[model samples]
Target chain A: MKDPRLLAVCCPDWPVVAACTATGTALHVPVAVVDGNEIVSTSAVARKEGIRRAMRRRAAEAMCPELVTFEHDPQRDARFFEPVAEAVEELAPGIEVVHPGLVAVPARGPVGYFGSAEQAAERIVDHIATHTGTEAQVGAADSLFAATKAAHRNMIVPPGRTPEFLRPLGVHELDAPELVDLLRRLGLKTLGAFADVPENAVATRFGGPATRQHRLARGVPERPLDKRRPAPELAVTETFDEPVERVDAAAFAAKLLSERLHENLAARSLACTRLGIHARTENDEELQRVWRAAEPLTPRGIADRVRWQLDGWLTRERLTSGIRTLTLEPVEVVDGTALQLGLWGHDDERAVRALLHVQGLLGPDGVLTPVIDGGRGPREQVRLVPWGDERTPTRNPDHPWPGRLTRAPATLADDPAALEDENGREVGVTGRLELTAQPKKLTIRGRTREVTAWAGPWPVDERWWAPDRHRAARVQVQADDQAFLLIRRDQRWFLEGVYD
Target chain B: MSRSATASLSELGVNPASELTSTTTDHATGRVLPVRGELAGLLPWGGLRRGSTVSVGGSTSLLLALLAGATADGCWAAVVGLPQLGVLAAAELGVAVQRLALVPRPGSDPGPVIAALLDGIDLVAVACPLPPSLARRLTARARQRKAVLIAFGAWPSPDVELTAESVSWNALDDGAETLRRQQIAVRSGGRGSAGRAKNVLLTFGEEEIELPLVAGGPDRSDEPADAGPDRADELAARRATTREQPA
Candidate 1:
């Protein structure tokens, strides 16, 4: 069957452009966006200076010392791209954002209106450049995958010619790294080579995901775009008694609405790939946009999209009032059997639901899960992340940190305390790790106790190069039945933890 | 009377028959989450019984220890309203930290939050004090959901109550060694099978605690302490073996 022709708009290095636009950095300046330690995207100027994607940040900096770098934030990129998507939507309605940098629409409406596919692409690209002041390329082909690839090269493949256009592309264009590597090892270096393999043989050798990629290689849709029409009741709407004027408020509402939408979809064993967000302003202005993804949207993914969209709308000067009504509707769905509960069993699902319920009651940051992180202090060693957020630790735990405590206290305290010697003089640690007084009495929160046992002053000097350097010495002292970890900093002793 | 004859007589009376059937069914289907080492002997049921409230008083380490075995056995546990909880200590005590969630500061009213957690989590340990009415309601909720509710502070009418009577820190001197191990004496008492007061000695070493495997008396000498992760694995393996034995 012939796949439906689609038109896709692509903005090269959108992250760099969005970063530049958000920070008001001129486009001529060399800029790169980094995720963690690696560069994700670079502006044209940086690319000219040999800064490539996946290059280490230090290498990029070493190559071009004047290059400005910004941490890659998807929400910021999406917020900046909203104007570009809006520009295209003015020329052609029913736009579906493939991601922050790309948007796709059915070619029939734009081509029929513009009289030719080339004219439609030209008009959309010109409209975006004029309205949003961003350079864009438009491509038209039989499938979204083919259209996206064509847009990257600014080409419009003629009707029924997508297979020819995709034939010479490298297998890396498939975007499945492992599958592409295996195909390259098997001498299928190009998409055409991979596509030439027999369908039954490919299905037997390769698995389900590979089969879908094989379809994309052959210029066929990965699956028949069923675009199931979700039940009207599946659309979740929330009417704010006090209109949401702040981004944080909207984000909280988005999390709740997305959870409800996901629950409704999961009940029917469906997952949304395309979502439509609708909002009504207090002044009776209505606004809407649609977002599409290659895979089904998880709850967090849906919430992020809603938040980015709302942030774009709320921050822009077009809206005169706050949003009064918000709605989330699944535009396209698919069988969600793959999204079923994990092998950990049904209790996990129930627990997740309960946690989500509490999150709804007390906001997302209310319920948290702990991750053991790398640090010298007990409080710094454990990072508490919100229930549904990523559980990645900020610092790597494997690095051997000197002067760390051998045993962690069962409880942590931040109370102010006084450590004094028997002579009634306050004790202190000298700069050379010398204690001014050996014997001491501990006074904590108005209660004084005699110190029975004592330990050394373990000094920690961190971030000595920066202006906010911290220099503190820790001591373990036992007073009566209680043992406390005390830190002497800025000439005062404060209780850090309790070994209960 | 013979067992068969008593059963026949009960079957002749409708009320007695239904009551007898309910009691037998409840006993047969009662689920118990495993506890670690010798700690099991302190509880009447030899484990944490589902739908029962167990309160731990005066010891945060004991509360964390109670959650370790069940979490390692694949049970989800959550702690509510204890912001100062030492998660690192919990990890060192063999709790599967990944399966544990913390609602550290649930604000002034933590009743709804704890109740919601009780609905989903297999075991919930709450340190916040709640009103008597809310506490009773939460207990009923836990019972309905077949979850274990662990109260950290004073609670009314719990199925089992554990208190730390004496605690001593080991491996510390005037100026030499650091604080390493701890010895705690925990006393348990409650209603029903747990009504009789019992005491157990738990030695918390650097990595994992040494609990006496036998219930005779507190034996603190000569038993080697295993590392935290290996002890968890051993407990998980033992649980698996126990589960398969019944099948």
Candidate 2:
């Protein structure tokens, strides 16, 4: 990695300037791209004008009456720079992208091949212009910072001329803005003036990091050449002309997406486990569902989960109305090895399919898996939820979880029932009825029972601070034949759950 | 494709009474029975089958209470479109509302919607305002599919063998609100066309009554003109407020 260098081609108004650039036509950044102090655009001409980006729109318009404003498009910008990255990759396989429009390619082999460093840079810039009809600028230095600075400023300081080239630049180039301003206040502006100052004086003011920078200003780059790595894997999508209401239809579309994803992954021979399904509703509610398969998922599995999650909204649940778009993003991929299928089949995926089928039949909570959390209270410790929906775990597992119950009740009380008194007459039930004390007998369905053993009138006072969601207490009791978990708050006895 | 499942469903014919009952996994052993009806002979099988749709006429509460008895031993049950029913009360009555899903039928796709819903979940009881064709289809499907199909009205279909009707014994028309809110009545009759089972009078919520089979009378007469569909409506209205009986 000898004399490795970095190259950055800034397209200040790439989206605004890319239609012609994509096909190799336009190259210059638009005038008035920047509105003020800010680099509102990559336009070289815009930088010369006082107009900067994001300054008062009126202010920008006043400076340049015919200035064109273009909406930013990441896709177009990426497409515009693809040839540039490819051109660099052609020179050397080792390349890294800092951004869609900025890339760094190693200059060692290419420089050596083209005779000398200057000749190599000139030939490469010529190649870039021929391939991508844009004025190509090349900068060569021992370090990426120096190379980037040279290209950004459009200077071609020859190989061994770095120290002399940096001598006249201001000290602020080395990131000592405060010190540079202080020196300028005292009427010292250039790097040569700073180099003339005692090294001890500079060290005493700016500390250790400043001393490191002092050496770099003498044209010595400290950054090491990095081994080339492939660009990050990303999934892309397109919207539909019409809304889709069926789950299978979404899966069908996602299958098409899977092909695109496979193409991207196969290019690098990689796979991922985590997938993201993004659905944009007609009402503009951006709903995102993430698929986290325990193992690598086939396109079908991805599609099924995507469809079911879409089922959670599009078909199964009522959407606001129409759908605007859909997106399937395999956000995270895993390093997967080729599987050697030992037999005609593997583990049964059919069981899970059947289980999901039955659950759909038996309402939501028909089939449940028992989940145990770190809670002392029986009810809080164990939760029996349908299948998915792991969102509402028993909270406060670490605290002395109260009450004595088994799994969380399969059903929640939609409306508070009228608790009956001893005579089976309706009584008042304003809040959660928790029996602070053990009831002597629990009569259910006109059948009276005895309370054999009991745990607590554990005051489960959750969200006492939140006025809307104030739950009180639940006391667990064991009878001769049955075990009941009783809940109470404002002095009443009603069973909330069972132990079986 | 394997043809076993469909054949098995056909082998197990439908029973009327158990159409809306859910099976409970016995607490002691986890043993599960497909149906549990205390009075099985009242329906064809003495058990309600899964996937069947049944309709019972008159009040919605009767169907709920009947289902409550079938599910009391820990079975699961579901009731669709009992619009006035309080689900929590059903849960407490031991009818596993957690195992239940109440579908809202605000419009009239009453037949198809109900059938499609039954296709997914076990149809315990569907409280619907069904027409004759829908009622007939539900009855026929319940028998073949081994599911219990019940309609809300006593509009009998040839598919039904036994029917329980709860009626208010003495609810006379008055210009005012209920003069009396006591004394419920019930009557049980089977195979009006076949003419076998008798009316079992039950003074509900009081002392029980016995069965006295009487045909060729106004209530169960062969002649449709004596009391047609309009009479059925009048009978239904009278049964709503007054106490009920079984024949």
Candidate 3:
């Protein structure tokens, strides 16, 4: 079967462009957007100075000493490209964004309207350049993948000649690096050469994924598009009584809407791959953006995308009023079986349901799970995370924390205690780590107990270089059958934990 | 085959005793969650029986130790209203903290919260006090759900009641060294098979020891040994000396 004809719009070095626009850097300046320590994208000027994608930041800096760098942020890229997408959408009504920098639209409508594919491409490119002040290249072919490749080189492939256009392209065009390397080693250096292999041979030799790539090389759709019109009920909408002006409030609403959308999809044995977020402000203005992912989106993934989109709209875009209505729609979906749970362990479905029910009764923070974090004191070592939230420790537990108690107390307490010497004088630690007087009795909450055995004054001088430096001494004292972990600070003794 | 025919066949040759034994064994194994270490001796079923309510009093470490074995074996446990529970100490006692949930503050009434947890979780330990009527209803719900309900304080009536009679710390004297271990004398009493009160001395921290086995009781020799040989030998010597006296 023949693939549908589509037109793709590509913006070269979009990340660099987005970074420049966001920071108001001149377009002619050498700029690079870096992720971690590697340069992910470079401007045209930076490329001329010997800086390339995936190059070390230090090496790039050494090549172009005047280069300006920005940390790679996908939200910023999407925010800056919103205007460009708006420009393309103005010319062609139905456009699907492949990503922040690329978009695709069905070729039939624009081609027929403009009298030819080339004219349509030229018109769209010209419109985007004039409206958004960003240079764009447009190409049309029998498939979106081929059109994307064509757009990169500013070429238009004839409708029936996508395969002929892809023939001389390098195997790297398949975008499967490992498979391309293998194909290169096997002397299949171009798409035509790889496509020349028999379908059965390719299947038997390279397995399933390679078979799909083989079909792509042959210029056919990898899989039959099974686009289904999602049920109207699947779209979750929330109308707030009060307009949401805060980012946190919008994030909370986004989380709820995403969860509801996920539940709706999961109920029908479906998972969304493309999601559309729409919002209506009190000023009667409408905002929309569609996000696409290669894999099906989990609830958390959907929530994060919605949050980022909302953040971009509220902060970056000028709005006369706060958002009044928010909606989350699943634009495309796949089989829910793709979202698999762990097969080995016992199912936590029951516990999760019960905890969620409890959370309903007493907010989200009522139910929590403990995570052991790194610290010297017992209280600082454990952090309680909300039940459904990610379980990440605030501090790394692998660090060697000297002066930490080897034996942790079974119970933590915040009680005030007084230590007295033989003559009923308050006991204190001296500057030289000496005891002013031997502790004989410990009084807690008006109850006096004799101290049988005690250990002392393990001083912890933490953050000594900072202005808010903390200086405290810990002592372990055994009063009869109960042991107390006492901390001395500001000339007062407090009970931190009890060995019960 | 008809019901009467199967009954006639059973009457002719089937051994009813063997059938009863097999059913009882399956029922016991399916209904109980295993508890390891010295604390296992305190329960009548040798583990935590489903639908049963157990009360743990006196020592927080003892409660954490009770949860350690089951949680380590992959059981999910939730603790309600235990804000001061030293989670690090629970980890030290061999509890899998990942499978454990904490509801430090369950609001004014914790009945519904604990009921919800008992319906799904394998075990629900509650420190908040409940009215006698509500406790009874929760016990019934626990039985229906086949989950264990543990009360950290007094309950209406529990299947097993464990109390730490006395506790003493070891390996420290006059600040020379840190505390290394603790010996707790736990006394277990309950209804039915556990009606006869029993006392067992358990050693916690560094090394765990269950000394002076009850006569005719289940032997735990087949359980995997987690302590070193020297520690095991020392425990054995202590066990021998303790066995000479009545427990």
Candidate 4:
């Protein structure tokens, strides 16, 4: 039997449309969605003013001065297009969303019911336009590529005329721009010229990418739609016969489920990089979370992540009901390589496993990794955050901190101690950021210490523009072999930290 | 020397079997990463032995000084339950910032924590006081995994027990205030080996740490002993530039 005809629906400038519509901007208003510095999509109004996709945002704005700019959010675009996809799904039981603003559906079922492919295409487009308040163009052809290209130009190609329709199209329509550019320089400018090259020659010269492009240029599906398998459920699950209310029980179960999942993945010579742990309570309440690793997850690493997730959900989330089902899904996977140690004894897998296990028991924030950051004070300069978390320091290290101290202390005290003078008078800073008294002594845990040597009161008055301002004078003092950093602020003396 | 002709000849001429056989040398026995120049003479093997425990006492600076070399050499080091560990001091002493992992408080009992760190890390420095039994078990685990365990507080008995004695501050003189130098007297002795007690002097300067030349070792002098990988890279780059320059 002949393959079922395919219908493609596409919405041009969907990101810009979604961004403008979400922000309550009119369609006639100049709008553009930018990814990084480059404009990803431009509205019809903006495009008319000479703004285009792939143009820099600054250049686009230069062309269209009144352009409403938005940072491109693929998640927001997909979220806004869900209703449009659902509208098509209603008419065609099984439709594939190719991307945020495009979808492909087998036309046989919908068109047979609607009497004709053109009638089916019109019905889908009208349903989406009315339901989603977005303009959509639809086309039907024997192959998805032809259908998509037809919708791209707002046309429909008859079943047997797909190749003829694709022939006059530019080689760039094959979507491998690098190969197309090279072929164009060689004077193969049209899809027909690219298609005329033998498949063997394309494979030998340009490899997999060019071969796929050549097939697409021949009006054949890059990969046949029927050859595509439904994405496999790569998750492992454990359904409790009786609900588990205790954290220990859930943690134990998570460990077992994690091992089982890892074993299944390992059998296929794959490793998970991003993992998702899901739990459903007896009352149907669900708790879902995703854990990402700096490196691939080992069996022990997976167990530790799952256990930490369970500990967090059970203790912190405070669910009303007990957990009835638990699932561990590897959201991302890569080919597994042999876990080999270098001659210098650097074993990353073992180290990661150990760290993950520690994180599980101590909580995610228990372990801290230290990074050298630019700041004046010892505590300010060293940034310590929970291990495995990616935190970019909010303060720019490169910015010059005026009146900042030069040397960092050896260690920062967990809590500050009071500083005093030789006469037992408290050392303090005045309203004008001046030291009230010389700091010669420090008292810690009832132990009075006298400084043998001392340095200046370097005043640091910062953030006077803000409501909360910091004003202090720092002094470095040495007592015997130990050195200390003392701060006097607001008529109070505090031991900032110590030198090793 | 056209690119296409050279590539085709190389592809056809290369013997795959000989290449594979030549590359397959047994590297199963993991070697201990060498220590920095300053502390290299202190250890018997010129480095911390893999699958061994070393007891570190006296000061946090000493513990950091011992680790700075191995960590700077690209080994991953994790400091567990060492809350008072001055990470800035470690960075200055020559530990690689990217290779060091700090777990200030690994809970009351850090057995599992230390074990996990030992699995993957080259050196796991644990400062918390653990029970004798637990310490023994962890040491055995370290031996099994071929990882080094550095005990900051105390352990029952370790292969090497290094203590910093007679530490004196030298930079603070006549109200100078800038503590640019320090002198530390380190004593080394351990179990199973000779009870030979050795004393060495370590000088901590602004940029690097060094050891004063002993009576017999005239070649050592006051050279920067703990010069890190940065120096090595600079040397490599200088050598490359020299090679490129015309005579």
Candidate 5:
């Protein structure tokens, strides 16, 4: 394939900058985004204060006492950077976003139309700066790697001079620390020195990745651009005469808007899987966010997403203005055939609405949904968590619970019953894991039942290593018409549950 | 020409207007859902009637057994206030796990919970004892909503009441501690001429508790029985296992 000149537009310290901009933090403040304990990205002010990328958070803070830290959020960066990408897309129709802060585009068409590669780069930089209010650097070269390096210093290399432009750059510019360190040990300090090594020698020494970069340093691109087809604009928008300041009002409005949007999609038998929500405030501020789900959206699902987004924006984002207009867009859609309907004669559509209404009245956690999990104990087997809040259970069911009952009892008694033998004396289990007496009769709620047949003194010893150790013996007794599973813990007997 | 054509259609005892609206009304509100073997014979209509409350008086096993057939046939069942329900046991009894919802501990007043479930769920099995007024309210709501309700214990009023009169546990005879199978004699009585006592002998095998059609006789082979549903379940199980395997 023919190699076309490509231009890369890059914004520095994008994650920290996006976080600061979203929170309205001043640019002059030193800021860094920390992943675990290391700084991933740092603002210009933080960098100037010797707080660099990958620096330990404690070390960075010590260097700059006033350093502000933000948790690294990829979603926040991508969501906030969408406007910048759109601004560049307006000037150069198709730009590939390699990540949050960087975008690359084929310069052949735009450069020829604008008369010069320099003019095309300037146009992109100007549009992004004017529209997104973010400073950007643009560089043009034959390969993405060389173009990215050129963009770091905002230079447009002339055709066939990419290798010459990259020659004086240090090996560190290759962006592979291990390869760079290896090259440095081999006495190769510059890109020109590394490229001078035989291609076969480099392949035998450093393998595939190093060879690909070696090709880039020699002005040859690894491959052509994977051209992207621009997504269609299938967004539904609505404007309110009055601005919505309250979250509940916004949620209600969002629900209605979702219904309107889904009705349009339903006619075409299409359902959106990935959705983008865009909001415009009274002060002319624009906010955009995207939500993705494993399953395609129903009208109710769309409404839940809109409400969740609104809740986060209003409560956590601390926006300066109220929303005046809102738009719901489908970023990706699939045929409705994958959508499953409720079973025969079941009206789940209405049930979901009723449950959601209940959830709203009661707190979100007031209503719960149940899921079956593998476990030994009666209470441990089924997990119940508030609807929409699915979490892993505290107990791991995969482990072998050695002393659990082999057969699950049919019913769990509301409360444990007291047991006694025919002598009208209480039955008990001793420390030796032996029954004190042969269990005979069972009494529950004042009713005494005669036990005709009885089974085990099956002992269970649990958590012997912990402070709270438990020792119990279980027995199966057939009394009157009902068969009961009784447990003796410590010295007393309590009816654990009933067997149906 | 159109008027003569319409007139001819109406004259043939086929009202053109009724034909257009007939499809909507054909969804019978009182239609009975087909159930498994002897349990079918126990009911007056040979199946579970919609908009009715049936009492499963004795065993929770009976409730799970009753749900197995309906849930296997793609009906959704909601179990409320029965926290100790052995859902794994229900799965072994052939109930579709995907179609089951458990609200084991429906706090304080379970009436609203059952009423809400009745609006959509085909069958609701409630285990808690209901006060007379709340029971009346739920029964009326169930009938109006056209959802079948199954109460685990004794209830105030029921269209059909199934009670396990006798339960005999099968032992190894050598006095080994393991208990194998259980045979329950369930008697159904309640409501209109349906009060005629009906008895069913259900045998619990390794996998399922089935009502043998001939009381104490050998198995019959006429009915395709569970083959169709079993194949569907196999396909679903195969799909699930394949998905769990790493690529």
Candidate 6:
């Protein structure tokens, strides 16, 4: 069998499992986890007290009474780690997530591209540590399973020893309940055991499943490279094993539903930009809410949205007791792209999100792409817009945009002396225009500058349309010497953009 | 590494040779015990390598550091007495805390617990309150599995590795001056069999760095003390805390 890249992940908590399943790939690396404080990992006392890995918190406590617990955020762990995965992607093609704790990537191209598999693995580990703020160990091998085992083993498998490396690992590394049980029944405890078993007999005993077990033991290919495709973006509806009533039951159902939804998304490289949730009560009534993935579109974010949707739908909407079924749909798709962290391709998603917003506002042709425009003024010469749709990139494509001389300002002073340069020397913002230095009004230089060319109060009414959809007040302003366009949205005045 | 095998074997309920080979078998030879099989690997002796006591003086960062590398090597290690070991810290540190034991104390006496571990257990930590005598005994038992015994400071045992002395390179903030995480100014007693040693310069990144004041000597060569296996300066400058004596 040819060598297949293996990505091994170890997610000891349910949140990790939920996150992993959402992403679709069998691999993941948890940055931080919720309920980590309570896990009774391998320890002298833990062994004596009879605790086990992947045991429920309550079960672990039962084994060793008084087991203290810690509640951490898995979302934070996922959020923190997307950068690492993105960083690794710089070295290879798309990552194939095996679990929330593991991912398998093709090694030939990366190794050959970088001159050697060892160097690539080393670079990946270093990049992840520096770019994503998480310490990771990367191993490359001919097979996905072998690679996963090697990674968990923390020994970067030299190109040739993948099969030899896997020989010693136990079969349970597969961690699939029924498969593991069958293998155990056959006394095939280790990869060596499966490797030693006759392929024909093994298949006869475990049927089809055993063949996979054999191939994995031999470092065989499981799946092809991760092809970014638009799989069916669908809704998941879960019915209780037993019909459940009560708001708590409904909430629990939502949690389960959200976990399933996230698992599907994670497995397929997809994220729902918009969501619509529905609950079927035991009384046959339905409670539903049309929502959005909100900010960042994380599993926790989705869960929060579900809870918020439930709260309003249940209390404000006055839905009565007990929900029998719950369904969630990914109404729209956004770039929810996997993160790339590091110098190679570590572009911040916040920047992407901002660009997406700009693109949405100005049709594709209305916005211009980011171009390096070096200019002397405060307004940046760089203009970013929706790709292909020509809004002509009217936004300044010049360096040192006015008002935000550092990042691209909204309004500029008649005289540069009025700018605030407190920490300017370091950040390159050399002006000292403290606009609010006195009252709500300020003197730019000698002349008092007031609001000039205006737009909003047009109340360009938004969600005027969707309730709670008003994000900010976008006021297009143009002063004489300085052209200013400001957005007084969400109570703060940010130069929504500049039109120099 | 043997500890993890033994643990998994035990988890699978597989029984093995019921005898302790001479003090040199790479993995411990024994009957697999029915436990979650926590295999925080031993140093190939029996328990924690000496000089492994990290001062858990209430800082979460330090506490997590203590259990972070419990399984850096493929060993089955168990922290018996330290029940309050932070789970999140351990997980983040790459230590699988799912099999940890939350015991008030391992046995009626720390000696018996040590004996149980020494009998056949691979890398079991019996967390009794640390005293010099208890540290010595626990350290004695750890010699078999080459296990690491990291006891808390409230039980300050003289025998364990005082890791803070080795890794802290920066100066300390005291009345006289301040210290960085990269260097520490040492004060020694200069007495005893270990010899009179005073004012030792302690540098960071060393395998083991003691305050150089002990009745016997130092044991800072363990892998966990200085995680970087690539430092020679760390090997040459190791000093025993017992070397500190009254001149």
TM-scores for every candidate against the unseen true structure: 0.69, 0.30, 0.65, 0.58, 0.49, 0.28
Query: In candidate 3, what are the lDDT values of residues A126-190, reduced to their tens digit?
Result: 99999889999998888767888999999989879999999999999987778899999999999
Model 1 Cα lDDT, one tens digit per residue, B83-144: 99999889878899888988888887888788888878999998888898899899899999
Q: Mind giving the per-residue lDDT tens digits that candidate 4 earns over A1-500?
A: 55746888888888987787779988888899988677889888888898887797888888878899999876567556666766887788656555567777777889789998778888888998888778999888777788889898877788789889989998877655578779989999999988898988976676544665777788875442222211256688899998988768976897679767865765565566667678999889987655544345656667766765565566545579889999888765664431111011223445544555566566556667787775556677678876654444545455544434434455666456677677878766544333466667777666678767765454443332233656556667777567777776655667777765
* Per-model CA lDDT versus the true structure: 0.79, 0.45, 0.76, 0.67, 0.67, 0.42
* Residue A432 displacement (Å), model 4: 5.5
Give TM-score values for chain A, per-prediction: 0.73, 0.39, 0.66, 0.52, 0.48, 0.38
Output the lDDT of residue B20, model 4. 27
- Which pairs of residues collide in candidate 4? A350-B120, A351-B120, A354-B116
User: Candidate 4 falls in which docking quality class?
Assistant: incorrect
Residue range A214-299, candidate 6, lDDT tens digits: 76687755432332333455568877767654446555666667767765664444555556677787778975544422122445
- When candidate 4 is compared with the true two-chain complex, its DockQ is 0.19
Model 5 residue A441 lDDT?
78
lDDT value, residue A381 of candidate 5? 65
lDDT of 1 by residue, A1-500 (tens): 33488999999999998888888999898999998778899998999999998798999999999999999999888888989999989888889998899999888889999999899999999999888889999998998899999999889999989999999999999877788889999999999998999877876687545767888899986444555677788899999999999989988998889888876775565767889999999999999999987767666778999999998888764788999999999987876532222112334667666776676566667788899887777888899888766676766566544445656788888989999999989988764454688656999999999898887566554331233645577888988877888988777889998888
lDDT of 3 by residue, B67-146 (tens): 88888876889999999999988887788998899999999988888888997899999899888999999989998999
- Classify candidate 1 by CAPRI docking class: acceptable
Docking class of 2: incorrect
Using TM-score as the yardstick, the better of models 5 and 6 is 5
Better of 1 and 3 by lDDT: 1
Better of 1 and 4 by DockQ: 1
Candidate 5: segments with Cα more than 4 A from true spot: A1-370, A386-401, A414-417, A420-426, A430-433, A445-447, A457-468, A489-492, B1-31, B83-89, B104-113, B126-146, B153-157, B166-180, B205-247
Q: Residue-wise lDDT of candidate 5 within A224-290, one digit each (tens)?
A: 2332221464578999888887878988898778877765665455566667788998888887765
Give the candidates in order of DockQ, highest first.
1, 3, 4, 5, 6, 2
Worst 10-residue stretch by lDDT in candidate 3 chain A?
A337-346
Residue pairs in collision within model 5: none
Tell me how candidate 2 scores on lDDT.
0.45
